[model samples]
Target chain A: MPVFGFYKLYLSSDRKYVKKLKNLLGFIPGNLSLYRMAFRHKSIATNVKKGVKNSNERLEFLGDAVLGSVVAEVLFKLYPYKDEGFLTELRSKIVSRVNLNALARKMGFEQLIEYDNRMVSNTRQGSLLGDAFEALIGAVYLDKGYEFTKDFLINHIIKSHIDIHKLEQTETNFKSKLIEWCQRHGKDVSFDLVENQEGESNKLFSVHAIIDGEVMGLGKEFSKKNAEKLSAEKACEALGI
Target chain B: MPVFGFYKLYLSSDRKYVKKLKNLLGFIPGNLSLYRMAFRHKSIATNVKKGVKNSNERLEFLGDAVLGSVVAEVLFKLYPYKDEGFLTELRSKIVSRVNLNALARKMGFEQLIEYDNRMVSNTRQGSLLGDAFEALIGAVYLDKGYEFTKDFLINHIIKSHIDIHKLEQTETNFKSKLIEWCQRHGKDVSFDLVENQEGESNKLFSVHAIIDGEVMGLGKEFSKKNAEKLSAEKACEALGI
Candidate 1:
C-alpha cells in the first residue's frame, strides 16, 4: 500500500474494522456506517426514532432486490432459450433462504454478524448470517453503484462460489420435495407401481402418486425410482406445492 | 429526428410500430423485436420450442426484478429512516398489478398489447396490460441498459405519474378495509392479542389479524389500536386486497 493511504488507515480508530471488511469483501467500504448497520441485528439495535432501529432489516430488503436482479440477468443471458417458469424456478433455488444460509456459512459471514445470542433461538440464529450476507450486498451497492455492485456479485460471488449446473440438478429432485410438502400439509402420500410396459430391456415402469386415496399423478419411466419421481413431480405441479 | 434518422424510420418495414413506440415511450427503441415480444401475450404466441413461447412472460419476470431493484433504491434514499415494512408496503403500492393496469391504460398501452381476446377473461385481460407494461420495461433494460431504464422509470413513469404522498394517505384505515373485504367474502375476521415478547417493553402490544380461523398477519406497536391497524394492513397486503 502507498505510505499516505496506509497512514490514513493507521490513524483511523476503525482501522481494524475497515481492514477486516476489506479482507472479507475485497473492497474498502466508502461509507463505514452503512456496513456497520448491515451487520447489526435488531435485538442489539436501540430504537433510533419513530419505532425504527439501526438494524440490518432495511438493508436486507434492499440487498435482496439487488441480488435478485443480478442473478436474474445472469440466468437470462446464460439460458437465453429457457422459459419464464425455468428462470423463476432456477432463481428461487439460487436465492432460497436455505441455500443463502449455507452460502453465508461457507463465506464466513458468521464472524461479522452482530446479534444478541440469548434473544435469537438456534433456528433463528441460522437466518442471521443469511440476512447479514444480503445486508453486505446492500452496503456495497450504496458505497459503490449498481454497475459496480453487479460486477461484484457476478465476479466475486456468483462465479467464485455458485455451481449453477449442479444447482439445476436439485430442480429434478421432486420426490423428496413432494414428501416434505405432504408432511407439512399433514396429508398422507404414497407412490405405487401401476404397471410395466414391455418385458425386456425396453421395459417402462409406470407409477402413480396418490394422496388421500386419490391418484394425483401418473408417470412412466425406464426405472421404478424415476417413474415414482416423475409421478411426484406431476403431483407437485398439480397441487402447486 | 435528424434527416438520416427520419429516412431510416420512413424506410423501415415497421415504421408505424416504431413511430407508435417512440411516441408512447418518449424514446425510439434500439431493438424493435424486443418491444414487439414485450407486447405479445402468451395466448396468441406460437410455441417456439421445448414448451417455450415467444411471449412477454420472460420479459415480465426480468422487468419485475429490475423494477423492484430500482424502486428499492428509490425508497431507500427517499425514506432513509423508514423501516423495511414501510418501504415494502410503499414499493408494492407503486408496482401492484392494479396500479400498473391503471397506468398502462392511462399511457395508451392497451393498443400495443396483442392477446387472443376470446381466450382471456375480463380480469385476466386487465392484468395483460400490466404484464405488457413490465415487459416493456424489460425491453428498455435490454435495449438501453440498466442506467437508461432506471432513468426512464424515475423520470417518465414514477415522477411524471405517481403521487407518493397521496398513496401513503390511502394506506390508512386498513383495519376497516380488511374487515369490509372479509365481510364481502363471507369470512369471519377478528383481531386477537398475541403474547408480547418476554424481554420486550410491558407497553408493547402484539396483535394478529385472524381470518377464517387462520392467522394472517402480526403487528407490534405501543398501543393496541395501532397494533390492530398495522396487523390489518399486513393482512390486507397479504390478501392483495
Candidate 2:
C-alpha cells in the first residue's frame, strides 16, 4: 500500500473507520479525536511547533485511575464478604503489567498504534502494549462517562478475564496467622538483619529469624519487613512452634 | 465505680450512645447490624452457636475497597495531569498504617473496643486501630450509600490529611526518557547483573548499565528490572546524552 493510501485506509476519521472501530469496541458515538489520540504513539512526531506536547501520556494517566476505580467498584459489589487485603490483591493481579499486555494484544491494538520505523524494530513490546491499553481506557471514559466506563470494564475486562471463585480462595493473612501461632505456643520470635547490600539498581535486605537464641530461618526481600516475615515463617516451620 | 454500676453505665443501648455515634459519623441509621458488625472485633467471643458471626473482618474488607475507590475518584478529579505511578504512591501514603491509626485514634475508638483482658494488653493496637477505621467506613456506607461514602471520604480523609501540592511536584518517567535519549544519540544501552545475593529475608539483584560497551552506571533493588532501571537512570546522568 502507498504511504498516503495507508493513511487513507487506516487513519481516516470517516464513517467507515468510525463504524469499524465502534463495532470492535462494542460501543458507538465516541469522540473520534480522543480515539485518535488514544492510538497515537510518541514515536510518530507531530508537526506542531516546539513546546506542544505530542504523546498520549496525559490521557494514560487519567485512564489508569479510571481503570483502577472501575475494577475496584465492581469487585466491591461482587464480593461483599471478601476483606480489604483480598480485594487489594485481586485488583493488583487484574491490573498487572502481564494482564494489561494480554488484554492489549487480544484487542489487536498493534494494528492501531502509529509508531515510526525506529520504534517498530524495538523489542520492548511490553511497555507499548501497556500504554495502549491505558490510552484506550482514557478514550472510552472521555467518549462516554463513568457509568459507561464502568459498564465496559465489567463486561470486557472483569467478566472475561478474572475468575471470581479463585479470587475468593486466595490466602492473605499468613503473617497474622504466624503471629497468632507464636502467641499460642509461647515462642519468642525475632528478626535480625543478616546483610544490607546496596547495588546500582535496588537495595536488598537479608534477614534471619532468631528463635531461642538460634538462627532458625533466613529470608531476603526488597523491603525489610517482607524479608522478616519470610524468615519468621521459615523459623516457625523449622521449630514447629 | 462498682462492677454492677459500671455495667449499667456502659452496656446500656441508650439514645445518647446512638445520637452521639450518629452525630460523630454524620450518618442516619437503617442497617444497624452492618454498623454493629463493623465495630465487633473477632476477639469478642459472641454466641456463634446460634449462627451470629462475631467479627467485623468481612465489613473491613468491603470498607477498605470502598475507601480506596472513593479516594482514587477524588484524586483523579483533583489532579488532572498526575500519572499512575504518582497517584499510586499518593494513595499509599494517604491510606498508610500511621495515617489510618491516627484517624482511628482521633475518632475515640480506643475506648469503644470490647477486647478481653488478654488481647487488650497485647500489642494488637495497630490491627485494632486499622480495623476500627475500616469499620467506621463500613458504618458510613451502610448508613448512607456510595454517594455519601464518596463525599465523606473527600471531606474527612483527603482534605484533612493528604498534601496535594507536594504530590503534584513529584517527577517520574526517568527510565523511558533515558531510553529515548540513547536511541536519539545512536548509542546502544544494556543492563548487566553485577551482583546476586540471597539472604534470609529476600533475594537482591544489582545491575550495571553499559552504554557503547562502557559501564555508565550501577543500581540495586529487590527485583532485577527495578535495579536495571536505576542503573539506566545513572547512565543517563553520567553520559548527559
Candidate 3:
C-alpha cells in the first residue's frame, strides 16, 4: 500500500520529468501518468503480472484516432467544396508513415521517448518516433480533452511543421496516375522486379516499368512498390502525362 | 438574410426531425443544420451557386474519425491487456464495411436517410447505409460534443445493437488464418475465380480455395475477395485448423 502511494506521489512530484515534459509539450501536464505512459515503449516495460498492461501501445492507438479526427476536421474545414476522396488523399499525404516519422523526429520526440536500447536502432527508429508522437496526442487528449488537443495539433503540429501547400503540390502516388494514363492511351503497362540486393539487414528492390516491350522507367528502393513508383514518376515526367 | 435566419429557426422548430432524432439518439440535437447535412446525400442536394457546399460527405468524413476514436477508446478500455495489433484487428472488424452496413441497415437508417432514388439500388445500398451511419455519428458529435457522442455510441450503438462478445468470437479474417495454416502445413494455397456469372445488374463471383491443387472449399458471392473469404472459412472448418 505504501509502495503504491509512493508511486502516485513520485509521478506527480518528479521535477525532472515535469521540466522535460514542459519543454517537449510546451506546457505542464495535468496528469503525469498519461505522459509517462506516452513515452514508455513496451520493450522496456517491467512485467509485473499476467493481466497487467504496460506501454504506450494503447495510448498510441487512442492518439492515432484523435489525431486522425483533428486532421480530418481541419481538412474538411480548409477545403470546403472538395470531395471526400480529395480530402482523404490529402490527409493521407500529410499523415503518411514516413511523413509522421520525419515530423516526430524533427519535434525531438525520439530523444524524449524511453525504450530498450537493445530493441531500437537507426533503422527502426522512424516508426518508433511516429508511434510515440501519436501516444503523446493520446496523453494530451486524456489530460486536456479534445478542444485542447485540437488546438495543440493545429498550432503546434500542423501549422508549425506541416506545409499543406507543398504537400498538395507533391503528388503522393505517381504510379496510379501513370497506369491510368497508359490505360487511356490503349497501352499496356507492367512492372518487373529486375534486381533485389540484400542490404546489411534488409533487401533493396529494383524495378522497371515496362510498356509495349520497352523499359519505360527504372527505379530502385528498399521496397518493390516504391521502386516501381519511382520509375513511374520518371516515366510520367518523360511522357508528360 | 431573412431566409437564412428563418432557416435556423425552422431547423430548431422542425418537430418531425426533432422527434425522429430524439427517438434515434435519446436526446434533442442543438445544431440541427449539422444533422440535416448528415442526412443530406450529394445526389439530392440542391445547387446554390458555385463555391457553396452541400451534402453529408464532409460530415461522413468527420463522423468516421469520431467513430474511430470512440471505438478505439472502447476497445482500449475493455481489453486492457490486449496488444495493439489485437485491438486494431478487433476495431477493424467492428468498423468494417460489412459490419457497419449490417448495423446501419438493422437500425433502419436507410429509411430515414435522404438520397436520390435514381442513384440507389439494393446492390449499391450497403455503402450508402454505412456512410449514412457514419454521417449520423458525425452529426451527433457536432450537436453534442465528445462526451455526448461517446455516450450515444456506448449506450445506443454498442450496448443495444452490437454484441461485442459474439464479434470477439468471430474470426473476421479467415483467409489470413487459412493461408498461414497452409504455409505451416507445407501446402500451396491459392484462390481461383472458377465461376463469374453476370446477374441482371451485378456479376456474381464463385471462388474456390485450392490447396495443393485440390479444391478444398467452394464459395459464391458478389465480390471476389468475399467469395474467397467464404471459401477460406469453409476450408478452415474442413481442415480443423
Which candidate achieves the best DockQ against the true structure? 3
DockQ for each model? 0.25, 0.11, 0.30
Q: Write the per-residue lDDT of candidate 1 for residues B105-216, one digit (tens) a residue.
A: 9999988999998998763687898889999888999999889999999999989888877886676578998998788779999999877532346788988898988778
What's the ranking of the predictions by TM-score, best on top? 1, 3, 2
Q: Candidate 1 or 2, higher DockQ? A: 1
Q: List model 1 lDDT by residue over A126-227, tens digit each.
A: 778878888888988988988999998888888888989889877557898889978976889999976432221346787889887777877778889898
Candidate 1: regions farther than 4 A off: A1-12, A171-241, B1-10, B172-241
Q: Give per-residue lDDT, candidate 2, residue B11.
A: 49
The 10-residue segment of model 1 chain A with minimum total lDDT is A194-203
Q: What share of the true interface contacts does candidate 1 keep?
A: 0.58
Tens-place lDDT digits, model 2, residues B43-120: 784754444345776566657766765666566566655555666677765665556777777767776655665656
Q: Which tens-of-lDDT digit does each residue in B1-241 have in candidate 3?
A: 6577446656655867778877777887776778888878777877544644578887888899999998998998898787778888889879876678889888877667888878865446557788888988888877688888998899988999898878888976889988987787689999887633212114767778889887777777888889999999888767644
What's the lDDT for all of these models?
0.85, 0.66, 0.80
**1 against 3, candidate with superior DockQ:** 3
For candidate 2, lDDT tens digit of each residue in A52-117?
A: 344666567668766876676667667665555666788876776556777787777777776676
Worst 10 residues of 3 chain B by lDDT: B195-204
The total of clashing pairs for model 1 equals: 0
Candidate maximizing TM-score: 1
